[model samples]
Target chain A: MRAAIFRGAFAIQVEQIPDAALLEPTDAVVQITHACICGTDLWPYRGQGPYQPGWQIGHEWMGIVQDIGSEVRTIKRGDRVIASYDFCDGTCEFCLQGLDSACVQGGLWGFGHEGGQAEAIRACFADATLVVVPPEVEGDEALLKAILPLTDVMAAGHHAAVSANVRAGGRVAVIGDGAVGLCATLAARRLGAEQIIVLGHQPQRLALARQFGATDIITSNGDEAVQQALEMTQGGAQAVLECVGAKETIQMAVTLSRPGGTVGFVGAPHGQEVPLGHMFSSNIGLRGGLAPARAYLPELLAEVLAGRLDPSSVLDRTVSLAEVAAGYAAMDQRQAIKVMVRP
Target chain B: MRAAIFRGAFAIQVEQIPDAALLEPTDAVVQITHACICGTDLWPYRGQGPYQPGWQIGHEWMGIVQDIGSEVRTIKRGDRVIASYDFCDGTCEFCLQGLDSACVQGGLWGFGHEGGQAEAIRACFADATLVVVPPEVEGDEALLKAILPLTDVMAAGHHAAVSANVRAGGRVAVIGDGAVGLCATLAARRLGAEQIIVLGHQPQRLALARQFGATDIITSNGDEAVQQALEMTQGGAQAVLECVGAKETIQMAVTLSRPGGTVGFVGAPHGQEVPLGHMFSSNIGLRGGLAPARAYLPELLAEVLAGRLDPSSVLDRTVSLAEVAAGYAAMDQRQAIKVMVRP
Candidate 1:
């Protein structure tokens, strides 16, 4: 099997690797069909995080099960499935509370376990970790790419909106306008927010955000953006989704929210500090983190299958497995919002 | 009339002042029976806040209505009442949302409007601001003093508990051992939290915290306190109430919470910065502010009248209006957790 392996900062290679097999009764081997790049993937790629040479380098995927272990009762070979970026037992106290991302036995794919960037990948806790993709749309190319991002970004965007308690007729502001932020705008729209603002400086990304239902856009001058959002919302946004993992972005999200409003942050913050003083007196709430992707994928998948939502729009470009390295580089250079790779 | 007026930093005097009278159609004149020293009062007394010389100095009180205007429908002359620290119309969008502290036309009694630290007070928006004292409990000294604190501290404590969503049989941690923190412990217990930890170093305050149903105590060392709380709860506390406005206290509260847990911060934050990196990954939420005291007084008054709760236990000493200066000095020096002043 060939896998996209991390060589070092700013480098990746698609090379022959040892084939993965079922290592436990609860495991399943998936032949990767589609995989996509994520903002989080850029962290290690940019030398901001620890990465080992030859490590499997992707976590987003949709695939077909090539083999299933004896104890895997819910899924079998040849079934199309979408797995979350993080694997969980789904029965732990955290999972039961709808915080599967924090599940005690969970393994973060790509980081903690061998990821799904290869031709074939092993998925653990198959019964609890895999979602059987609905069969009615099995051969749809766009839907297949959509599922890959859904395993992480789309679900994360939904989590951000949900955590902020976005409601019908409410004003919502999405900070970042990255893939997740655009998805959040769509999610907020789906949740019935009447007004949506996407704050970003990138022209292409902001244009995509507007297409995704943002009623307004503000370039990354955070202070001015917050002021404009406040004026537009008659005070401040009823809910704010902070999708960027920087201190300024989070602060802007907090300040843009109305008194008693909520700020849901989904970014994997690397070097950010929250201003608690501003939040305390403003009565703003901060909630969100790693998306409970598995918990949300079913509904998001249904929306995608039903054509009520289109997350595939975020897949600005696609490349073959042999060109996976270039895809990563494009994403690293901010030239692409999202890159999909056909395996 | 005689009133305690703030002259400068560390300077307060009980001296002759003009009597208060009805200033609006919705106004009521009350002869204060008991006015208590509050933690917020120390802010101006110590010159830590913006203060003007010879300003009225208190916001917590229970009194007898001496007069009312044509528009005052809720109470008449001779009615005994306990009013919140801030006056609100109770009909604005914020008030309807149960955030009376941010009411559109709200006025703070001590900071901006004429306060209740004197023998007489002119209360605006009387119908929406005052809670009538039950006849049977009007003369009860403990209940009267309790009513004074209810105008601020007790209500603030309840706000903390409510914002944090403290549940029955859940573990709760309270940061700060001020009157509000002690009241927060009591509020958590009332809301059915089975285990309560109060973080503080003062013996007298900690003893009062215990009396208010704190099951454990963590002295000022926040990091050790978080670890101890996590160990006690088998993970992390389900809810944390931050009653001190310091940055470290806010950080500790955020750290002590479990994933998906909330921290209710009622403290008027002086200067605090939140660590967004940890907050984003942990999924901890923060909610609260200057408590909407006007929203909770009715229920709080009912509880006090029924002998189900007592807030006066926080009062460590009492002084005459003439000796209020000493009371402030005592609280500032940690000689007393709280003090009550009789006019």
Candidate 2:
């Protein structure tokens, strides 16, 4: 089966890997129908994150269940479903607490398990890890790309909004213009933010941010961006969502928030250190971690099916599974916002 | 007038000083009736925090309004009131958001104004900074000690609980056995926590913790405390209150909380740095800063006035204004939980 593999830094390849098989009673095999290159995928491609020479590389995926182990009772063969990046046993204490990201036995798809950018993938904890697409929209290709976001990015954006405590009529500042940031802008809007502002310099991405519910955009950085946000909010935003994990973005999140507001960060932080005294003096609340995507699936998926959210606007380009390297290169070179692949 | 001054490391002296008088139209002078030596006060006494010899040193006090500036409308001469450690304008955006600690014109009691550990204090923002003692309990000394906590420690503890999102049926673990920790135990109970645990080795402080509604006590530190907390909670406490600003206590607060729980801290952290990756991977929510005591006052003061909440048990000793140095020495030597100064 053809799958995406990390050959080296700046080198991702579409190569034939061993086929997946049911390894446990709780496991299910999924035939890859659609997949996409994620922002995190660019981490290794840019030599920013861990680089393994030969490991399966994608996590966001949606496909049809080709087969299931005996223990899988809720899902069966040939059902379209979205599998979140994280797989967890639904009954663990952490899972029950809506912290599936910290589930004792949970595993991220690209690590320990096979990558989703393949012909088929084997998923453990199938009953608790997969969410079936509503029947009415399952056959549409456009809807496929839209629903695929629920597997990771959209849910992550929702987590950022929830962490920042975004509410109806609240104001939010989204830092970063990546797919996740755009999704967060949209999520904050769906959560009823009266003022949605995006801070980014990229023209194409910023345009998408506006379409996704950003009421304004500041093509600036540092204190300049902060000033614009404060001026727009008439003081400072109630919530600041840091979607890019860079230290600069994190600092900007703090700078853009009001004294009593919150900053929610979902990006994997890089060299970020919080000045305790400043955070204390300002009474700013910092929250957010890995998204409990599975925990948010049912509600967000309903929004997607109801046509209330169209997250696939982030998918600016598409390709066949065999041309996966081109997909990675395009996003890496900033030639495309995101890439979708049909297997 | 006379006031305590930081003479040098491990040295404080009660010496003759200029009397407090109203200078600003928003100012009001208070005749110090009672004051308390704070845990933060011991910082300079033990040579830990910034040491400025001869600087006015106390921040918590309650007294009768001695005089008022022409603009001071809320408080009048001869009225009993509590002067909190923080002075906020009460009309700023941050103040209106219930975050008086972050008020734009706010300043600590001793910095830009006279410290309260003197015969009198000149308080700024009088209308917003002082809360009147209920008429029914004005002359009650026992009730005075109880209501005094509402000005600082009790309100700070309540901030920790509110920051950690403690709710009915939740479990709480309070680290540090100082006045703030004991008060946090009381506040968590008031916030409706089902179980409360204190982690400290001081027997007397632990006894006070129980009296303040702690259900259990763990006299350990480091990983040992973590293991015991895990065992007691069968996982971890729902909320961990870090009242000690040391590096070790902050780490314990993170280590002792459940995966999805929050750690609320009110201590003025001394050079603390967070391991962002560990906190993120664990899905622990860290929320806390300086407490907005003024926002929490009316409710807590009501409880105190109603004879439902008593926070003065932590005040284990008393001293006259002339014996201020002795009060500091006793508290610095761990011979007293807290010292109540009668000016």
Candidate 3:
């Protein structure tokens, strides 16, 4: 099997690797049909996060089940399914509370298990880890490409909206114009936020944001952007989505929220100190952490099948499995928002 | 008039001072019938928070409105009322969203205005700052003292429950065994939390917590308390109320919560760094800052009048205004949960 590997910092390659097989009765093997490179992958790609040579490198995926262990009850062979980047049993206390990301028995893919950016991969807890691709989206290549982002990106955006309690007729400010940020704008719109403001300095990203449903865009960075957001919303937005988990972005998110509004941050935290005094004295509420993307996949998938969502726009570039290394380079260079991988 | 002054660290005095008088048309002078020393007041008492010599200290109050400026509308002279520690313009965007503590026109007391532990207090935005004491409890001294904590402690507990979204049938862990923690146990009961766990050390405070509706008590401290709470809940609590602002308390609050659970912290943040990585990976939602007691005043006032609540039990010691300094000492030494002063 051909698999994408993280060779080292700024180094990636496609190589012949051992084929994936069932290690547990609950496991199922899938032939990767589509996969996507996420912004988070860049952390290790740039050596900001720890990585070992030859680490399997992608998590977002959709594929056809090639085989299933005898114990797998829900998923069967030959069925198409969208994979959850984080594996969960769906019945643990955390998953029962809709927090699938923190599943006690399941962990992130590409860490211990083989990554999705490969010819085939073993999915642990297959009965709970895989959701069948809606029949409406079957055989639709464009839909398949679009729905692939749901495994992480779109579901994350939807999580941001839900976490912030974004209500109809309410205003929200989405910080960071990455794929997650753009998806947040769309998700806020889908959740009925009347005024969606996307804050970022990148013109191209901001433009794509507008197309996704942002009612306004602010092309400024830091404090100035927060001030503009506050002014635009007449004080501050009811919900501020901090999609970039940096110290500055977190602070800006707090500033962009109204006194009683909520700042729901979905980005991976960078150990930023949330301004305790600011959040407390202002009576502002801060929520959201890692999104339970698996919890949101079904709903986001329905939206995609119904044509209310088409997030494939975030897939600005595509590459064959052998060319995934180049795909990573394009994303790192800001030449593309996200890159789709065909296996 | 006599007013309590924060002379220096561990020093408080009730000294003869000029009488409080209306400075604005929206101001009203209240003859304080009751006031209490709060846990947060200890911050400066311990020389932790910023303070000034002879700064007017107290912030909780309930009294008869002796005078009202011409523009005061909702409240009038001779009405018995409960004063919010924080003054606010009811019409401001923040106050409109029930965040009166962050009123655009108001900050906290003791900055420029007279503190509540005085014979008289000039309350700005009288109509918005005071809630009329129901006629039925106008002459009830015990009831008034019981309601005094509502201005800060009890209201804060309620804020924790609401902020953490403690729903009916949910289990909650209230960290801290202070007046606020006891009130939080009471609040979780009021909000319909089924199993209320109180984490603290003092047997007296824990006993009071049970009286206030705590179903379980863990006297152990630190990581042990969290593990015990986790065991009692069979996993982790749905809501965690952090009433102690210490760094370690915040960490415990997160540890006590289940994934997707919320930790509502109402303590004056000692600027403790929230463990973003722990909170993020656990999918734990953190919310709560300052409590807008004024927002919860009306409902709580009704509860008090209806005899559904009697928090005066937290007022373990009583002292005349002349001995107010001793009242501060009692709380500072942990000899009393809270001390009430009659001026």
Candidate 4:
């Protein structure tokens, strides 16, 4: 099986690897149909995070089930599916409470387990982690584009909006104009927010954000952005979706939120210290984290299937497994919002 | 008029000061019958916060309205009332949304405007800030005690629980043993939390916490208390109320909350920095600050009038006007949980 393997900083190679198989009773073997690079993948590629030299590197995927273990009851062999970046036992307390990201036995693909950026991949907790595509939608390009990101990005965007408690007539702001931030703009719009502000400096990304339902845009001057956000919302945003985890982004999200409003931060924060006094004094709420992707995939897929959301718009480039390294380079240089790779 | 004035650190004097009068068109002058030293009041006296010399201190009070400005409509002379620590224009959007503490024109009584620590205090936004004592309740000492804290501490505790979204059958952990913490325990109980853990090192405060319906107590031993709380509540507390504004207590509160749970912080956080990465990764929600005391006072007053809640039991001492300085000393030395001062 050919897989995209991380060799070193900014280096990825499509190399032959041993075929995947069911490692647990709840596991499923899937033949990868589509996979993509995520912003999180850039961490290891940039040498900012630990990366095992031959680790398969990708977490977002839409594929066809090739085989299933005995305990996999809901999904069957030959089923087309979208699987989340992390696998979780659905019956766990955390999973039942819609916190699949915190499931006791959950494991991250690409990092700890085999990932989908390959010809074939092994998925654990198959029944709970896989969302089968409707037969009517099989192989549809638009649906596939939407489905692939649902496994991660779209769900992450939804996580940001939901955690921030976005609602009808509320004012919402997205801090990052990455794929996740654009999706968040759409999510807030879908959730009935009357005003959506996207803060980004990149022209292309900001334009996409506007197309995705952003009512306003603030080019990344932190102070001016916060002031504009507050002024536009008549005080401050009712909910701020922080999709960029940098310290400046986090602070901007907090500062832009109205007193008693919520700041939903989905971006994985790097080296950032939060001012506790400021947060406390403003009566602001903070909620975010790794997306409970599995918990949200079904709903996101439903929306995608209905053509209500189009997460595929974020895909700036698509390539074959052999060109996987270029996808990383394009994303690293901010040349692409996202890159989809065919296995 | 006699008032308790902060002369210096650990030094207070009860001396005659100019009597307060209506300072604004919306102001009212109140002749305080009772006032108390809050946990925050001890901050400056303990030399832990910046204190200006000869600053009049107390903010919590129950009194009779002595004079009303032409703009004061809801409150009039001779009406018995309970006033919040902060005065707000109730007609503002923020106030209408139940965020009185964030009112644009609001001013904190003790910190910014004339406070009720004196015989007569000028209250701004009288119509929006004062809650009248029900005519049916007269000469009730317990109700008086309960109502006094409702002006700030009790209301703040209730805000903590409400802000954290405490639900029936949920588990709550309160990190602090001050008046606000004890009030949080009571508020959590009122909100129907099935399990309540009060973390503290003092026996008397712990006993009071238990009396206020805390089902468990964790004698502080660093992270051990958080571990015990997590173990007791299965994964972690569904809601954690941080009543101590110190860094360690804030950290402990976040540590004890389960993923997706809320950490309601009502304490005036000092110089503390929280790690955003840890909080974001855990998906714990944080909400709180300067408890919109005016918002909760009506409901809390109802509970008190109905004999369903009593907050004054936490008061360990009561001093006359001349000995008000001693009340601060007692609280500063940890000799009293709360002190009620009679004028």
- Which of the numbered candidates is closest to the native, going by highest DockQ? 4
Instruction: Give a tens-digit lDDT track for model 4, residues B132-211.
Output: 99766668776787778888899889989998889999999998988999999999999999999999888999999999
Model 3 chain B poorest 10 in a row by lDDT: B105-114
TM-score of chain B of each: 0.97, 0.97, 0.97, 0.96
Model 4, global lDDT: 0.87
Model 2 clashing residue pairs (backbone): none
Tens digits of lDDT, candidate 2, B1-343:
9998888788888889888888899998999999989888887888876657878988899999989999988888889999678889999878998889888888777643578788998888899999988577776889999988777898889899999989999989999889999999998999899989999889999998998889999997799999999899888988999898787788788888887888898988766376566667776777788899888888899898787899988888999999989999899889999899999
The CA root-mean-square deviation of candidate 3, after full C-alpha superposition on the true structure, stands at 2.5
Clash pairs, candidate 3, are A280-B289
**TM-score for every candidate vs. truth?**
0.97, 0.93, 0.93, 0.97
Pairs that collide, model 4: none
Cα lDDT tens digits for candidate 4, A299-319: 887888888888788998998
Off by over 4 Å in 2: A7-11, A17-19, A46-54, A227-235, B6-11, B17-19, B22-26, B44-55, B67-78
lDDT of 3 by residue, B94-162 (tens): 788888888888766775468988898989888888899866776777877778888888998889889
What ranges in model 1 sit over 4 Å off? A270-272
Task: Give lDDT per model, in order.
Answer: 0.86, 0.87, 0.86, 0.87
- Per-candidate DockQ values are 0.65, 0.62, 0.66, 0.69
Error of 3 at A87 (Å): 2.1
Q: How is the predicted docking of candidate 4 categorized under the CAPRI scheme?
A: medium
